[model samples]
Target: MRLIVKIMLLFPVLLYSQSNFEKAEKLFSQEKYALAKPIFENVIKENPNHLKALEYLGDIEGMNKSWDSAMFYYGKLKQLNPKEANYYYKYGGCLGMKAKDCNKFKALGMISDIKSSFEKAIQLNPNHIEARWALIELYLQLPGIVGGSERKAQKYANELLKISPVDGYLAKGHIAEYFERYKDAEKNYTKAIAIGGSKTTYQKLADLYKNKMNQPQRAKLVLETYQDKTKS
Candidate 1:
C-alpha cells in the first residue's frame, strides 16, 4: 500500500521532468536560448547526468558569448565523453575566445591547448570541415616563432580542396594576400567567386582591389554587384 502510493507520487514527477525537457529542447531548436536556458538548468537539477541538457546549456552559453561559462559546460561534457569530436571542438572554440580577450602572455599559454583540442577533434573526425578551417586560420595567423607556418596553412588549404573547392581557393587567396602576391590573390579570389558567388568572397575581392591593388573603380563595381544580388 505504501509502495503503491510512493510509485503514484513519483509518476507525476517523472512526467513533469519529461515535459520540461521536451519544452526546453523545442525552444533550443528554435534558437530561443534565453528562454530555454533556465528550463534546461531545471532539467539538469532533476537529472544531473542529462547529457542533452548539459550539451544544450553549453551551446546556449556559447551562442551568448559567455566563453568561460561555455567552457565550464563543454569541459564537463568532454570529461564525460572524451571521444566526442564536437565537444572538443566547442571547448577549443571557447578557449580561443577566452584567449582573444586575454593578455599576450596568457593567450600564448592557451595556444598549445587550443591547438591540441582542435587536433584531437580532427583526429576523432577526419572530415570535420570547420576544424580544418580553424587549423588553417591558426597556422596562417601565428608567428613562425610560435606555430604559424604558411606551408602548414597551404597544406591545410590543399586538404580543404578535397573537401570544398570554394573554401580551398579562398584559403589560397588569403595566403597569397599575406605574402603580398596581389595578382595571385586576385586570381584565386576570382576563381572562388566564379565557383561560388558568396557575399564574403565578393567582399574579399572588393577589399583586395580597393586596398591592395588601389583600384577603387573595380572595388565599387564589385560592391554594386553584391548589393544588387543581395537585394534581389
Candidate 2:
C-alpha cells in the first residue's frame, strides 16, 4: 500500500515533465528554438538525464553557432550514454567548429580530440554515414603534417560509395574541387548527377562550372536541364 501510494505521488510529476518535454519537442520541430530552449531547460531541470532534451538543446545551440554551449550539452550526453555514437559525433563537430575561430595553435592542439571523437563514433557504428562524411571533410581540410591525406579522404569516400552512391560521388567531386582539379571534379559531379539527379547534385555541378571553371554557359545549360527534368 505504501509503494502504491508512492507511485501515485510520482505519476503526476512524471506526467507533467513528459507533457513539458512534448511541448518543447513540438516547438523544436517547428524551429522555434528560442521558445523551445526554455521548455527543454525546464525538462532537464526536472529530469537531469533527459536524453532527448539534452540532444535537442545541443542541436539548437549548434544551429545558433554557440559551439561551446553545444559542446557542453553534447559532452554531458556522451558521459551519460557513452555508447551513443551520435553524441560523440556531435561533440566532435562542435569541437571542430570551435577550433575554427580560435588561434591556429589551439586548433592544432584540439586535432587529436576532434579526430578521436569522430573516429570513436565510427568505431561504435560501422555503418554511420554522417560520421564517415565528417572524417572525410576533416582529412580534406587538415594539413598533411597534421594527419591530412587525400588518400584517407578518398577511402571514406569509397566507403560512402558502398553505403550511398550519390554521397560518394559528391565527396569525390568535393575533394577534386578543393584541389583545383576542375576537370576531375566535373567528371565526378557529372557522375553524381547521372546517378542521383537531385536539385543539390545539379546545383553542385552548376556551381563548379559557374564559380570555379568560369563557364557561365555551361552553368546555365545545367540548370536548364535540371528544370526540364523536373518538369517532366
Candidate 3:
C-alpha cells in the first residue's frame, strides 16, 4: 500500500510535461481526482511511453480500488521500466486483489499468481519493502498445504522487523491472527496500536476480539477508537 502511495505521489512528475500536465496536477492537488483523470488519460494517449502518465494511471486505478485496471496499467509501466520497485510492488497488489476476489475453487490459482507477482517484484528489487509485506500478507491468508507457511510468515516478519521494529509487531500480529492464536494476536495487535495505528489494524484487532476471541468488550473499545478516528 505504501508502494501504491509512492506511485501516486510520483504522478505529479507529469506536471513537467508542458502546460497540460500542469493543469492536471493543479486539479489533482485540489483533490479533484475525477477531474484530473481524463487529462492524465489524454497524456497517456499522446505518449504511451510517458512513464509518469502510465505510473499515474496505475495510481488512479489503485486510488479507485479498480484492481483489474490497476494491474493493466502497472503491467504496461513495468514493461517500460522493469527496475523500479513500486511498479512491481503495485503489480503485486493487483494480484493480491485478484486472489481476494477469486472463488474458493480458483483461490489456489489466484494465490499462485499473487505469489509469482510478489516474487518477481522482490527479485527485481529486494529493497521493495511493500512487496515483501504483500508477500507476507498473502502467506498469512493463504493455506499451508499450498506454499503458505507460518514459518515463511515468521521469516518475512523477521525481515520486516529489521526495517521497522514496531511495524514488525504489526506483521507478527497478522501472523497470529492467521494461525488462530487469538490471545497472542490480541497482544500483538495491542502493541501495534500502542504505536501509531491505522483503520486496517484496528479492524483486524476488533474482528479477532469480537468474533474469534469472544471478547466483545475489547472489540467495542477498538471499534470506538476506529469510529473516532474516522469521524475526526
User: Which candidate achieves the best lDDT against the true structure?
Assistant: 2
Q: Between candidates 1 and 3, name the one with more favorable lDDT.
A: 1
Off by over 4 Å in 1: 1-15, 25-32, 224-232
Ranking by TM-score: 2, 1, 3
Worst 10 residues of 2 by lDDT: 122-131
- Report how far off residue 142 is in candidate 1 (Å): 1.9
> Which candidate do you rate higher for TM-score, 1 or 3?
1
> Can you give the lDDT of residue 15 in candidate 1?
91
Ranking by lDDT: 2, 1, 3
User: Which digits, one per residue and each the tens of the lDDT, describe model 2 over residues 1-232?
Assistant: 9999999999999999999999999999998999999999999999999999999999999999999999999999998999999998999999999999999999999999998998999889888889889999999999999999999999999998998899999999999999999999999999999999999999999999999999999999999999999899
The residue ranges of model 2 lying beyond 4 angstroms of the native Cα positions read none
Any residue pairs clashing in model 1, and if so which? none
Q: Model 1: how far is 188 from its true place, Å?
A: 1.6
Scored by TM-score, the top model is 2
Q: What are the root-mean-square deviations of the candidates from the true structure over C-alphas?
A: 3.0, 1.1, 8.8
TM match of model 1 to true structure: 0.83
